[model samples]
Target: MLSADRMRAHLDNARRHLDTARSHTGRVATATGTAAATTGLFTTAVMGESLLATLAATGLGLLVLPTHKARQPEPEKVIERTADGGMLVYTPPAPPSHQGRTAAVLYATPGVGLVGVLIAEWIVPGFHWGEALAVALWSAGTWLLRPARRARHMLVPPLPPVEKVHDLVVQDEPQLYAHPAAQWWAERVAIEGGAAPATVLEDVEKTGESAMRAIIRASIPGEPVPDISVRRLSALMDVPQDLITVGPVPGRGASVQLLTVGQADAAALDPARLWAERIAPLAMPGATITAINLGSMNLSKEDA
Candidate 1:
């Protein structure tokens, strides 16, 4: 029977073998694609072997090219001397950093295509400057296609109005100026644990027969924004003075408008009730009536 350590070692070795096999497969696919795309780049008929070698090298080079990986702080290690002159290693365990907001991105080297070109020049016989150029072209193509981290756009369809909404005079009703831009750090955070992969918010346009003009585009900032700031914004939903908007008031109705640009990341704030809570304060004081679905407000110009 194998010990647990031996079993674990076997598993690790298997994983490494699988990884190498996968790497080889990807290189083959990449080389094939390059051959197809670069057929026009070089005179294949004149330099068959050299061109094939160039393409192969270029494809394989891309996967191996080194790029910057997100660096993490190494665990602090302490060495203690024992009574028998033996040294014991101790690693101070610490809680993982609350990186809920930090976004993760897979960065690629832009010039690696050129690296592939150089590699092909060295390995393939009869390789010429033209073939080198093809390698560079293939490298650039691979670099562009490599998947990496990106910002997350948080905008869901305009959510239903917040709870406890009461009809208020249209003139007295204040327009909810867009929340000051927040740097949705979630976009840059690693795209794992069900987190979003991108950010997509835009200006809220004028909709419906109402007279309200476009006030402003509400979006989180590009920089990592603190949750405290967003939480404060949510809290202010109850403050009448903080309410800001523009344009003449439209006809009054029993329904409350929860405006949203319908972007992808819009739902991110739903768990925190950022929109509904904000609308609650602007309703008639002490009046707990607000319309959840006041018919659809067409966001498109053709609906007008």
Candidate 2:
């Protein structure tokens, strides 16, 4: 029912999962086997093959057994081929942000409760192997659950609502406008350019290699501000005046067209490749409005 390529993909994924589980199980087996053997030596010397020593020897034997195996199961996802020869991958529902924290709390609870019991046992002059086992179990549970919570978050990353126009430009960290430069030209232009109290909306259709455009509808207490100057934006953005441009949008009286342009080398790459690499990943699918942060672009090669 499946193509050869699809079958091969599934098999490859399964093999990778098995390899990871095998690696974890191997480490666990070695550690547990070594601990059990050490316990056997100590107890046999003290009590001479007592019940506790016998149990340690049995656990060591189990760890060395050829038939013993351990494998961790991963969360499931659905993948299907669309009619248009496209791949549609579906991730499971996102886990809560506090999932890892909750797991840590739960795992710590038993250890907290056993603190008094452990103190009482330590008051006696004997080494309590059961207390040691309990502590190790709690530590292992906490450690193992951390990776599981992280994997769940990776499978379904959270997508918060776009609160403002600036959020579209900087998806990862919208709060911080720019890196070292602090080029928050939009806020500056709206205030100093006589366009204070402006409503900015991205012009998704007009965005391309040349410029990233937005419509600014500005107003004062009494009347609407019709236009904002390119020079003002240029000064605010801290870029060359030629890189920034402004125009009037049709049928929008109080709105001014704010166009942000990139460096000269932007048009060197093919449009399709450029869109795929730079633009497509930033735009959300089925989004009605999109933000493009092309103007006054930050180059990695720029000296510090």
Candidate 3:
């Protein structure tokens, strides 16, 4: 859905709005027809395939349209044009922090009042606002005991559209994109903003088949260090035990490198050909994450 042109976004929105309007008009027409019949204002003899009846039929036709052809609910989101002339459509933001006065006020406003009235009528000696105030204070104090917000941003950009690479894409560089796993791995790796990274769990071991692995830290900062041991091997499903023997490289950002073993050696990089420049760039419309490893992954002649 990524598009450099904001006009295209507007066009897409327009198309969506048009479909919604049509759906609404169809519903209105059906309702109007029903009302007219119920009130006895309209009768069959007077409406027999004449111009008025023809118009009514056309209006009713929209309702009878196949369910599969129905219009989807229009999006409430507005795709605003960004400072960079690019547009940004907001995804769902992380939940609000519940540790502050906000949470206290929320509890005090409802739960405290209700609980206080019940207590006053049954257990407490008094039925007064003062007692309610005291209960609200107690609720607020207990809420403070809960965990605090970590200031995390959960609504990262959506994943790039999974696309079909041309036939020649795999053929031209079998060393990089040959095996079915090559493109699969590339798509995972190309996910911008670090969704694919995890800690290396074990030392690299290989047979003729594959290797085992794990992770240290994941993409989000302050996220718990993942259990990368063999006990939690399923966390890194894409890392086949046969092809890539991933291990910790101390002092690296991710501290992990996927090394090619006998079977994984089939994915060895050949720099003579460049797919990044030669291939289409990944498209992520209105995404906050910058595209990486998208255009080119080969050595230029200058480097050679």
Candidate 3, residues 123-212, lDDT tens digits: the string is 444345554455455445434431111110011112333355673355454234444444443455423433343322232333234532
TM-score of each: 0.21, 0.24, 0.18
Report the C-alpha lDDT of model 2 over 1-304, residue by residue, as the tens digit.
9999999878776766654674475446435433543443334342333334434533553343322122223446879999999999997764443544443444234324334333434454456676566546644653455332233233333333326776566545433333222224334444443433344334332345444544444534335544556565566566678876565544344434434454434443445544554345445333332345556856686653
| Candidate 2 weakest ten by summed lDDT | 64-73
Stretches of model 2 off by over 4 angstroms after superposition = 45-227, 230-252, 256-304
**Rank order (by TM-score, best first):** 2, 1, 3
**Residue-wise C-alpha lDDT for candidate 1, range 1-304, written one tens digit per residue:** 9999999878777766655575565556556545543543444353445446545554454444322232344688899999999999998874343231131222223224434554454456554667756865665665456422121111111223334446654464422324332223222321232122232222343332322112112133443211122223234333232232322112222121122222224344442343343334444334443344547756777765
lDDT score, candidate 1 = 0.39
Q: How accurate is candidate 2 locally (lDDT)?
A: 0.46
Q: Residue 22 of candidate 3: its Cα lDDT?
A: 52
Q: Comparing 1 and 3 by TM-score, which wins?
A: 1
Flag clash pairs in model 2. Answer: none
Better of 1 and 3 by lDDT: 1
RMSD, candidate 2, Å: 26.4
TM-score for candidate 3, residues paired by index = 0.18
